[model samples]
Target chain A: GESVGLHLPTLSVQEGDNSIINCAYSNSASDYFIWYKQESGKGPQFIIDIRSNMDKRQGQRVTVLLNKTVKHLSLQIAATQPGDSAVYFCAENKATDKLIFGTGTRLQVFP
Target chain B: SQTIHQWPATLVQPVGSPLSLECTVEGTSNPNLYWYRQAAGRGLQLLFYSIGIDQISSEVPQNLSASRPQDRQFILSSKKLLLSDSGFYLCAWSPILWGLRINTEAFFGHGTRLTVV
Candidate 1:
């Protein structure tokens, strides 16, 4: 069975520091990947996405790196802020357009 | 320019009561709809997905069911709610690309918190 999972359950970071979240997926056929941020009592919000064709993609203050050989995915957040505190999840887009999500890593930013 | 809307930000129902959560998409047509549940400290569990009206796919076998009566309307229902069904329900939508049913990115609604007491 194919599954996506996170490397850490929780992460703590100081303000202005960089944060890295890791994810590993088992489905080699997956073509697209996305990162979502979910705040308390809210639905997961789309942050950024990268296709399998590209190794890396950059957004406003975020970046997503995909390693096809290792079947690994990572999200990097620059200048962590209090507002950035939330749970981050990595998802893989299957051929059917169904996204399989990881357990998620809670990102805590301390001021 | 598309948005998803889900109602009843919070809910509390008896264990045996019935449940119905509604989700609709605007600014798009013929989008793919999905239902997902998130338990405390867990990941998103996909429940059901629909590519078109009356066409649905169930990812998990449970007490829950979903329907797509209209192109942009999706509903999650259950005849008898269970304690295990209490969780955060999220509705998402994605545009279908031409010639293929694949979607680029999914957009989610605010979500509904259902607590079966």
Candidate 2:
């Protein structure tokens, strides 16, 4: 069975520091990957996505890096803020149009 | 612009009781709809998906089932519920862009929290 997983269950960072979250997926056939931010009592919000053809993609203040050979993916957040505290999930897009999600890493930003 | 709506924000049900959760999408036609369940401290698990009206594909085997009566309406139902079925349920939609290419970015609804007592 193919699955996606995170390297850490929780990550803490200083408000002004940079944050990095890591993920590993087992499905080699996946063609697309996405990162989502989920706040309490809310649905997962799409932050950024990268296609298999590309190794890295950048958004407003976030970036997604993918390593196909290692089956690894990572999300980087610059200048972490208190508002960035939430659960982050990485997902892989399967051929069936379904997404396989990782358990998620809770990002805690301290002042 | 597309939006997804899922309701009753919260629900409580007893064992062996029937359950029904509804999800609807607006402002998009012929979009792909999906149902996902997220347990505490876990990731979202894909339960079902529909590409068109009355066309559904189930990912995992369980006591639950899903249906798409209309292009924008999807329903998750169970004849009898189990305590393990209690979790946060979400509905999402992604538009099909450029022929059969499915959009990688999916929009999600608020979500429904189910507590089986």
Candidate 3:
């Protein structure tokens, strides 16, 4: 079965530092990938996205790098803040426009 | 300018009770709407999706059903709620723009926290 998963289940970083989260996907046909942030009690918020044709994309303090060769994806956050603590999800959209999301990585930033 | 609205923000219903959660989009017409369920300690599972009015496609078979009555309104309903239905339900939509492309961006509304007691 085609699936997307994270390399770490949880990640902790100190405020003002940097955070890196990794994901690996199995579907080669999945042309679109997105990273979302979900706070404790809200829906997932769109962070950044990358198309299969592109290897990298950046937004604000975050950067998304796609390694199609290894089927790997990563999200890097600079100057991590307390507000950055949340569950992060990586989703892959297949040709049908259906998104398959990873289990999620819980990012805990300490002040 | 597109906004997705899903409510009630939270719900507590007993098992066997009927369920209805509504999601309406303002600023986008005939968008592709989707319903997803996030169970405790689990990932987001796609339940149903609709591309247009009265059109629906179910990916998972459960006690849930979805409907698109208008171009911008999508609804998820069930004859009876189950304990397994207690989870986070999110409504999302993609712009009804060009042809099918995996790179299309989708946005979500404040999810509905469902708790079946």
Model 3 has a DockQ score of 0.68
TM-score of each: 0.97, 0.97, 0.95
Model 2 DockQ (Cα-based): 0.75
Q: What are the runs in model 2 whose C-alpha is more than 4 Å off?
A: none
* lDDT for residue A106 in candidate 3, whole number 0-100: 94
Those runs of model 3 whose alpha carbons end farther than 4 Å from true positions after fitting are B99-102
The C-alpha stretches of model 1 lying farther than 4 A from their native spots are none
TM-score of B-chain for each predicted structure, in order? 0.96, 0.96, 0.94
For candidate 3, lDDT tens digit of each residue in A30-79?
88999999887888888999999899999999999999999999999999
Who is ahead in DockQ, 1 or 3? 1
Tens-place lDDT per residue, model 2, A1-111, is 899999999999999899999999999989899999999989999999999999999988899999999999999999999999999999988867777789999999999
Candidate 1 RMSD to the correct structure: 1.0
DockQ each candidate and list the results: 0.75, 0.75, 0.68
Model 1: which residue pairs collide?
none
